[model samples]
Target: MKTSSFYVAFDEAHKPRGKIAGNYSHLKEFLDSQGFICQPYMEFPITRQNLSPYDILVIPCPDFAKFSTNEIDAIAQWVKEDGGGLLALSHAGGDKGRRSNLSELVEKFGLSFENDQVLDYSKNFGLENLPEVVNFSPPHPITEGITSLCFRAGCSLSTVGLNVVPVAISNEESDPFSTPLIVTAEVQEGRVVAIGSYEMFRNEIPGGFEQPGHQEFCSNIFQWLKTEYREKVKTGEIKPKVTIQEPTQNYDANGITANVGSQPSFISAKLNLSSHIVISDKSDLANLFHGLLDEVTVLKDQIKTVIETIVSSEEQILETQKATESAEAATPLELPPNIEPLPVPEPERLTEMPEKPKSMKDTKKKTDTHLPKTKTHQPQPIPDPLPMTKEEIEVELETLKNKLNSIENLKDLVESKYKNKSYTKAQYEKQIERLSNDLNRSLNRIKELEMQYTKGKK
Candidate 1:
């Protein structure tokens, strides 16, 4: 079980240089503790090749300069081809802080940032500017354990793509009835999360993550983004290079060279006239080449062995099939003979009955009394009627909702029973896994129905 670290790059070009703001030290510290290597993006004119090495690219409150057309194109292509993750953050009032244009980049993935800021006078933190968000969409991993979140001067966002989803939304009491502050979308093979307020991740900002559930939300975001890369690293899909500790010193060919000690100090040793053996040094070179050739020969032998093993396996498989066929042909199956109907026996005559004791006869007479027969009737079957389009959609939507509720209840029951010590750890885990799968299916069905309903309106 080997593990590897993922490289995370922050966009320094657009980072807020304000002494107090635009810094991601807190975010970096949290990610670092999770075994991620954080660094500033070095590519000036960002390209796909330059961004390939990093698993996630963080664009935090870009204020000074917006992503150029080329940079946007490269970033999109990089995410699509490299299967990387992206975290794009923007502040309140659209680009109020003179930030660079990010909509152009995110719009390519079907995400749009609203210009107006979302504020709730009643459900805010101290000041009306910082709105507390309590309304969250149903059971997403990102918002699984999260119940509430607070935003500072954050704008709203929306997406139209089927793969795009709103992670968190403002309550109906807010100015915008159902404003989505945070969103996530699947772009090709990559994942992108867009948060409206950069202040939420900042350290010293008022109404910052110090509020309840904010830190947990951030952790969820990190977990979702890095889950794939972490698995890849553990399975050795991505390898990190190992560096040597020896000092590397380069020497110049100044016509004169001196060895300070017996050990060679240069990363590569200089060839002095006295040390050089012109044509006679062929033996070492020949031996090195011969060793390489021997290695090649060994590889060829291994390949040949593998091919032979595969061929043998194929032959064995063919032989097994032939044997199975021969057995089936040799032992032909026969159908069972038809079963005969049993003969019905006739009843004995009453005149041949034997006499019984007075008490037994009296008891039998009392027990055997005559009864009247009743008639039987068959009911007609009812036919199913054709459902209206709207009625069908509603029925499906209700069914999905009911299934979702059932899953939730089952999940709660499992947790309660596990807590009560009714289930072992292994049993609890197995049940949880099955319930989670059911929950996911129910959510997907609900989303599909909602989409269909919206399209019907149009």
Candidate 2:
């Protein structure tokens, strides 16, 4: 296998800089173990002439506020034409003071870093109560094996005109509009992998924080970058093959027994029952058989544990569903209060009329006879309606209380569902037990089979 080479770039004027400062050291060590030669720019000045020698170029979180447009353009053009892989990391230092030139560099590949920190209480990493959990979307090769990763002081990322693929997402409880934890884009001829935070690869995060396949993730990037180089030297792929041989038949008191040997043997006897036999190299065949048996045993235990965990989870889900249904059923329907009908006035008896009023001309000669004719129909004031009955009010209040209680119950159910414990511990324990038992059983079985085969041969 040909080794891959990577050139890491860092800002010169910045302190606490260089590849070894942050996650770079972790990345370098991981790549080196996979037969990659990582060269840091700080060790040798980064010039256009020197850049052409590297297969991949990595830019760590740098204080790029002082870099001129020409410098950014130079780096961008180099990546676009040479088809070299680029990695851009962001941190608190690069986000503050002046506009980061790193932002301009990433913009060439159609990515941008937002000047805001992503704080997610739900996805936070570690015990410090900071948002650190990153949710991956699906099975992309780059992020296929990573479910969640720990990050410290992460920023946000956004994309522009390029077709960017997001690798990880912040929890919903975090800033919804902020950048994802990781993003990538394929530009003119090169690819760019952008990491929003540098703390993920830090020394304090612990090595085992990532999922089972994260080490492969670290290797894939470098391997992808050096794929062309590796292809030139690769010969042929190696694959394992298996061949089964027929065994000789021998009749014995224990029904019909087949004589299984590494090589075919000549033996004649009447068979009580015909059975297909297999033969192969004793050691190789035994090892393969033992491996399969071990795997099967392990699988059985794993399946059993998984079934139990699924059953428990299903029961919890059912309980939550029932609670939800009850809460919904208990919701009260409100009805408008009953209106009282107005009382009809009783018929009044006609009263005798006195003398008729004098004419307007006769009244006008007397005192102020211009008194306005009284309104023929005067409007009567309506009486205020009585308040609703105490019973009615109590019934309405009780309905409201019931409605509130139902709402509270629904809220409780939701919280409980989210707070429910996961099957992590139980699944892990089962897996460990199953694997251990299978290993032990396989060893014992192999020993017994070897002894039996040896005795039969003699």
Candidate 3:
């Protein structure tokens, strides 16, 4: 019956700079009011081992640094096996500068976040920046009692799995025609929710949570998460006891019949002998019936006593066998006559082994008269090899190729940034110069390794 606990991660390399900027204190306080344990989860790169302690994990508005392959796999596995809840919040331009690579994590649960932003001028709040979301669809457990919400610079969600539910959508003014704002889904034994905006739960934003139905929407999300973990607890609790019905018997003047319950025991076994019985004489029928009833009662008690005795004897025999085994193991084995024990030599005798006739030591001593004495092996410092083997050279060549590819990607990103006016011309030139130097050095190394590999092959 304890409250649910949440671990909010803020250790992302590109998380918003200041507390007021990306902090979720408003959400934390609200969760606290609902009797939840909220704690900051700074120690991460979220793995399965560390995730077991929390009922729910919240990564609110992460950065462009994508989670490692192992981390993504761990989070997915933890959610499925531990029945953990996950909440991923992404901002506009997902995977772009200062934004998150949340798609890697969300895709595991069959959810996706679009790179473009959703702008609704007509249905938005007072400012165009705050896109109003009045289209709450499906009305799931997480979106219960939620009709309207205002999102600040949020993106859109897409469903890739049958289990995925579109919780909300943008209006007609959205950049892309009426897209999904929030997506929720179930994966294995767990639940997941992905929202396009993190700012909806932030405090002190102009008409953020102050807007109508914002707080209710936030409450419903956490409430559903908490209820999920609680339901799992209830399902795994001790099962109810089964009831056994009494045996029923029907009697006629001509014959008697007995009906046994489903779980047939000793009584049923006895009844198997005769389903029907007949009596010929009416004069002694009453006496015979009384005698038969008494006999059955005695027989039942005898059978119960016999079963208990057999069970007790079996347990006693098992314990006795275990004790005998332990005793035998503790005792040492007797030595065989064929295997003679070696005699313990005197202390002085133990210092030196007896020499055999014409031993290798005598031969070596004679040979040493003509041979030069050997010098001590003074270990020389071995230099590190450069692509010593063909395999090594091939691996280095592949690594260089990957580095070159990365450099090209960086160049493309730089161009994109310049076009977006995020970098000045001078800044762009300096970055390009550094990247060019790295690319040139990598290309040269790749050529050298290739030449060495060819020579080795020849």
Candidate 4:
């Protein structure tokens, strides 16, 4: 197979600075390793004829301000007619010298470069408080595997049209209301991926080398370009299969070969059958099956862990409920006894006797009468009803049932779909096991809730 060729057209007048250059150099090495022939535009003339042979073209952060209108138009026409890929990166839009021609190029593809430099103190990257760290949209393949990226100094972009796909986003940290990054139009029937920050490809920024999605973005773009070229080849559309045939020999009853052609036909059939079996073995189907099984095994293990965690939590909740119930039951309730009242007829006589007697025994009796009697019985404080509300219990039960049902359905679906395809059996089993674990966790949760409800009723 012929290797795909790529041409990287960087404007020396507007080329990416410092780390950006270094990063591009690294990208070049990476693509070369993948069997692509990469050539920088700086080493060649930036003309339509010069770029015609390349499968992919990249205009990396070109200082369009230096390019004349005629120069920009030439590049646009080349892409339109030849269907070669184009990547354009720009700085803040107001820099007329650099942005003028580049902006024009992007516009031809239904995209516009915004003239604002985004300042986001909230999402700033470094300790210096510059908003270099930017978040991206999770949906696009270019942004896949990238959660956050740091760009030294980057601009924002805007676009319109179905061909554009927003690869990244600036959160509240950039501008409260601004679309920060975008990819515009399809390339040679494939899409052109554009990013707002030229700094994302620079090396000086911390994590520039290790940033999530950086490598993937570069790789995916080139791969996409290669796919476009491959689709162009008539014979490359599908791979051809090999066939083998066996020859046969036959003889006439007269001991001399009467029909030599008949003998060859008989031998050909047997040989063909043997060759077919040999060719089938070379398909590497076994290796493909093993790889799929391995993936499934890993998935199954993850599911098991999740289930265990859920079960442990459910048990803890059950134990807590039981302890609460025991504590409530152990609390004592006491009722005080009633006392009888003495007769009141001796009130006047008692006053007279107290005045006449000054003896120790009489003094003791008077002190006892003056003291207030203690009451024994007090009603126990009423216990409040169990804490679980009706709505809460019903919701818990419903959730548990739903989780179980989901798991069962998933397991059945996987098993039925993958039964005949055991080479990838692990993948299906892994999904099934994961679903089963989820169901088990739900069942455990349901049990815990039932226990709580029963205790509350008691």
Query: Which prediction has the highest TM-score against the true structure?
Result: 1
Candidate 2 structure quality by residue, lDDT tens digits, 23-92: 3455556666776655434212234444554556666566323345666666676566555578777753
TM-scores for the candidates: 0.50, 0.45, 0.49, 0.45
Off by over 4 Å in 4: 1-23, 43-45, 97-100, 127-138, 187-190, 210-212, 227-458
Cα lDDT for residue 107, candidate 4: 68
Runs of candidate 3 with Cα error greater than 4 angstroms are 1-22, 97-99, 227-230, 234-458
User: Quick one: best lDDT, which candidate?
Assistant: 1
Cα deviation at 202, candidate 4, in Å, is 2.0
Comparing 2 and 3 on lDDT, the stronger one:
3
Clashing residue pairs in candidate 2 (N, C-alpha, C atoms within 3 angstroms): 123-133, 124-131, 124-132, 125-132, 157-179
User: Cα RMSD to native, each candidate?
Assistant: 31.6, 40.2, 27.7, 38.3
* TM match of model 4 to true structure: 0.45
Please list the C-alpha lDDT of all candidates, in the order they appear. Answer: 0.64, 0.50, 0.62, 0.51
* lDDT, candidate 3, 185-277, per-residue tens: 777667888988776765666545556787888778876665354354535452211121111232122111222222212222212233344
Deviation from native of the Cα of residue 19 in model 4, angstroms: 9.2
Compare candidates 1 and 3 on lDDT and give the better one: 1
lDDT of each residue in 237-332, candidate 1, tens digit only: 865322111112222221011223222212232222223322324533552344345335433543454465557777888999999999988966
lDDT of 3: 0.62
Prediction-by-prediction clash tally? 1, 5, 1, 22
Q: Model 2: which ten-residue window has the lowest total lDDT?
A: 238-247
